[model samples]
Target chain A: MQFTCAKEDLLTAIGTVNRAASKMQKTILECILFSCGETGITLRATDIALSIKTEMNAQVEQTGDAAIPAKLLYEIIGRFPESDVTFKSVGENSMEISCLNSKVVLQQMDADEFPIFPALEDKEQIKLPQCVLRTMINQTLFAAAVNEDKPILTGLLFDIEPGSLTVVALDGYRMAVRRQAAISDIARKCVIPSRTLREVSRIISDTEENVKISISGNMALFEAGNTEIYTRLLEGEYINYKNLLPADCATSVKVETNMLKDSLERASILAREGNNNVVKFEISEKNLEITSNSEMGNIDEQIPVITEGKDLVIAFNAKYVLDVLKNVEESEVLMQYNTGVSPCVVKQENSDAYEYLILPVQLREE
Target chain B: MQFTCAKEDLLTAIGTVNRAASKMQKTILECILFSCGETGITLRATDIALSIKTEMNAQVEQTGDAAIPAKLLYEIIGRFPESDVTFKSVGENSMEISCLNSKVVLQQMDADEFPIFPALEDKEQIKLPQCVLRTMINQTLFAAAVNEDKPILTGLLFDIEPGSLTVVALDGYRMAVRRQAAISDIARKCVIPSRTLREVSRIISDTEENVKISISGNMALFEAGNTEIYTRLLEGEYINYKNLLPADCATSVKVETNMLKDSLERASILAREGNNNVVKFEISEKNLEITSNSEMGNIDEQIPVITEGKDLVIAFNAKYVLDVLKNVEESEVLMQYNTGVSPCVVKQENSDAYEYLILPVQLREE
Candidate 1:
């Protein structure tokens, strides 16, 4: 499209939609369409599953459109001198980008060849504060299954009710949940891929503005400030994680989060050398003992804590315990579990806003 | 080793010898030997061809020694709590590292199994400022061939005369040399692998002290501050690079180093898309036109300059020009060439400290 914009403006616009650009080889679909008109310049990219559209104000001399290779244009523009950059539609399927004393003629695909983006209906739109959404995504996305063997496990379930919202993600080994108050009157639930939520969190870092959420059919849309991201919602029922959490425990201990995390991390040094990577936790009055043994070495460390009920000992994958402890913001975390066989419950002290469940690893009999 | 030292002190010593630790699997040689005496604690690691030894002050509880996995010990020391860290020779093939409330039992190999580093003779030694040696290494190392097809091409030749020292590296395509006046009486020459020089530069950053150089047989030692690096000299004589450089050229032009570099980098964007990555330069009067054409696109950009002799057009790999220009510290660079087929010479104004020779690519007959 024929448009003149500041080097920084176009660069920012390109970055906003760059994540959705498909990296698939040998297809025109791996391009970002630039549409310039009275509404400035609109940039759109889609990889079928994920799509993003962003707009920037530009001085449009002629109304036109051009589909340019996303990554190539980004690198070219990143190296161009800062000032007013001019983009002009030139000889068939080519565009000229001129800035300062340099001009780049980039080969482009036909704009008409770009696939049409879906227009989601705004039936029941929900708005959430960017900071809250950002925190929830970061806190829960890590627990999602990285492998696509179970598609539902790769997504975070967003359960929104009249006055509350709970975000949950679970792999077979562990689960992470974050709860926050909601202002929306409507009740709806959606399973959004963790990848989509990750992209949302990154965009949230750009601004503090609230994100407007809307959905139509099986697609979910998130509009954060000037950028909008669309992701296909996962079908099928998500696993019922609430029922999986242990409701009763024979023992519970309040330990400093940082201290516990450090002990686990140290134990991991030896545990990681072994495939099992299991760290044993033995609790008594006023202290918790963390230990690990592997071919490389063994670790035995004690951390001060306040224990309630009967003392107990448990063992778990060092990585699983470290993950939850590292995420806990408070100084103390309440760990609850029933004997060594039950899953352990880890939560911030005096607050139910966040919870992490880690299954205990069976310690080999000596 | 039975010694107690601050966490940071032991950490820094480990870092100094880290590069020499062998990465090959299933070898007890992939460890660092900790030798303690009335003097201090010395840590040493050798990968057969390269070795580093560093000493740090510590409280010698008892004079003893142990060999621990280099990387694992470094990580353990890095994560240890801040305080005096104690190391003790414990059970057979194991050591206990304790600090604050934590203790690590690391499996170790016998210190006797670690190879003894060579004690270089003091015959005809040379000393140069660390900054000077660092600069010389960085300026010429990039021209060395990465592949060992012709092992000699991967080493930098260090030639020393009465008061002059020259460092040169060539990989057939290009050559880089740095010549400086010597501060020592001894005159000797050696060919050092680029990998060794790179490690020496890294250690130089840790201290501004001058480096003492000593060579014995096939081994060269570089002692900077408390750290010493020993490298096996590349055997079988280095090439005579002085005779390869042309003494005279038909044309020489003065151009701003930054201006020429920027032009080359931009042209590289398109040139890199082609098989040859060649950028053509046409110089006439005070103008230098840089152009490149590839399957993806083409670039035609002009940068102003001061030219002399016949008007000329030459093509060369844009990467080579960019490499030398990026290394040049002066504002202006002298570009000399005899003809389109001859090698081009790039040098800083009024200095023999550095010289770069880049062979031109034969321009494709349009």
Candidate 2:
């Protein structure tokens, strides 16, 4: 087999597919199937749970195939200067790569042992701009449960309706919900692994270009530009999170996003030393008082805010509050509290595109 | 005690002395002795082997001392916004820090238990531009022995003459020597620990400002601007590296520093897979051919060069050669070779500011 391609183009393709190949695998699963056809060169890698396939333009000399170690090939191509690199099969299990005055012969695995990329039939499809999809994933993915205690909570639920899509993720402590307008004929829902969503977000360009997502029986496919990602849908039903959001609150406050984030970040410095990382917030007339204490030190900070209704005092894990505040891009955010021990709900001041529910820690009086 | 100062100034002073305080220590050594008097605020930390003291201007309301944890103070000050910060002793073991609307009361160790800074007598002194001293240390420190197999070899030798100061470091395989002109009243020699030199290099400004270096019986003092660094000298005789340089060579090759560096970096990718990163070089009349092979792959690269005298082939540890190439800022470098087994001498093409001798690895015929 022989083909020539630009180093940059090949490197990008390898990088996208290598992410899947680098995961813990057995035998030939760790290699990427590199093949050249009449159209161009195609690279595919899979670790049984997740798979990626990408294609790039290349000048095909002879059509052939080989399974190359994904990471080694990526590293080698990255080091090459910006120039055209040519790959030619040498023997039964060797491939020769040459670029400029440099030449390398790399060992290759048998292409016959590599798994085939699964062909998918779109049972339901939804299309949205890459930028919108990226925002939805980034804002909600952080709340996904990292441990497998519930199995289903480890994945983000992608709920699709006739004209809207909402992504939701919740650990036991916090939940994030993002809603975007996307048109689809059939209503469907699927839980995608957090790892797959993260990689998809990284691979998709943050531009106005649209990415088409197709969901089938137990697999979901993401197609954008010349790359395709196929991942296994998590099994089991996700928790019903709609009933958990508080409908009304006795106290409401509006504050600048950056001001709250910065104060919480400082308060977390001391709170991080303790097991619970609890920071107390005393919301009153026109100011929010935040305080945290540990064995080593204690910190007290105050930021101005507009408050309505009755005053409230609550405590929460600083990390959860900080995470939501950081993900929120609005200049001003509105927070609602029903009681000291009830979960607090934060939303954008003027828009309802995103909502966050954070459970408060039970504060013990000293 | 009460004092107020700009957060930036306080942060910088704490950062400088905090390096020495962060090292593993016992009791109060882990804390920085923060004191305010007529000379402003003085901060000192010691790990017995190395110590640092620095001073910054502050509004001294009342003169007093407290031992503050180095890392904690640094982190807290770094998080505060740019503003005036005030510190006051709340009680016997607590220091209250206030900045803007943030207040923190940090636990402190007893100040009386902290060790006092040592007094040093300048038996011999040398003053040179901070930039020159920084360059001398940077150009040679990489060759210092990392292990304590030979206690003295782990430190860089400071050979101070009446008009020149030469810094040399060598492991068993390679040696780096840097020399610069500096006037000294009396000739002196001392082996400074690599850790001390590294910290000194980091603290010194890379400018034309002069730094006064004082060498006493057992400790060396480096005073630059408002910072003072005191370190214990390694006690032993340094290796005699002057005689180790090859007097002449049978072959000489001049190549672009970046071109050779890039070629070797690519070759090293394959060479690194083996137990020893040995890359072979064939110096002919017009080209330098480099090659390396391992179980995974083999790379062959060639770069044009001007070679005078007999042709030669040699092999070396790619890391040593790459280290020197990365350090040398010259566009072109001159490499002299005596034989395949003899040490290769690398120097600046037109200047004698730095010299590197790398021992060649024995090339066994396959």
| Top TM-score prediction, candidate number | 2
Residue clash pairs of candidate 2: none
DockQ of 2: 0.81
Query: Model 2, range A1-366, lDDT digits (tens) per residue?
Result: 999999999999999999899544336887999988997999999997899999999999999899988877888888898999999999779999999999999989889999878877756899999999999999999999999899999999999998889999999999999999986877998999999999999999989998999999999999999999999999998888899988888999999998888888888888988647899999998999999999878999999999998999999999999999989888899999999999999998767799999999998968
Prediction-by-prediction clash tally: 0, 0
| Runs off by more than 4 Å, candidate 2 | A23-26, B23-26
| lDDT (10s digit) by residue, model 2, range B1-366 | 789999999999998999898544336888999988965999898888899999999999999999988887888899999999999999769999999989999999889988878788755899899999999999999999999899899999999998889999999999999989986866888999999999999999989998888999989999999889999999987778899988888999999999999889988888998638999999999999999999888999989999999999999999999999999988999999999999999998767788899999999888
lDDT digits (tens) for residues B14-94 of candidate 1: 999988999874466789888899879999999989999999999988897888898888887888877899888887778
Candidate 1: where are CA atoms >4 Å away?
A: B206-208
Candidate no. 1 TM-score: 0.97
The lowest-lDDT stretch of 10 consecutive residues in candidate 2 chain A is: A21-30
True contacts kept of each: 0.53, 0.81
- Candidates in order, TM-scores: namely 0.97, 0.98
Q: Can you list the residue pairs that collide in candidate 1?
A: none
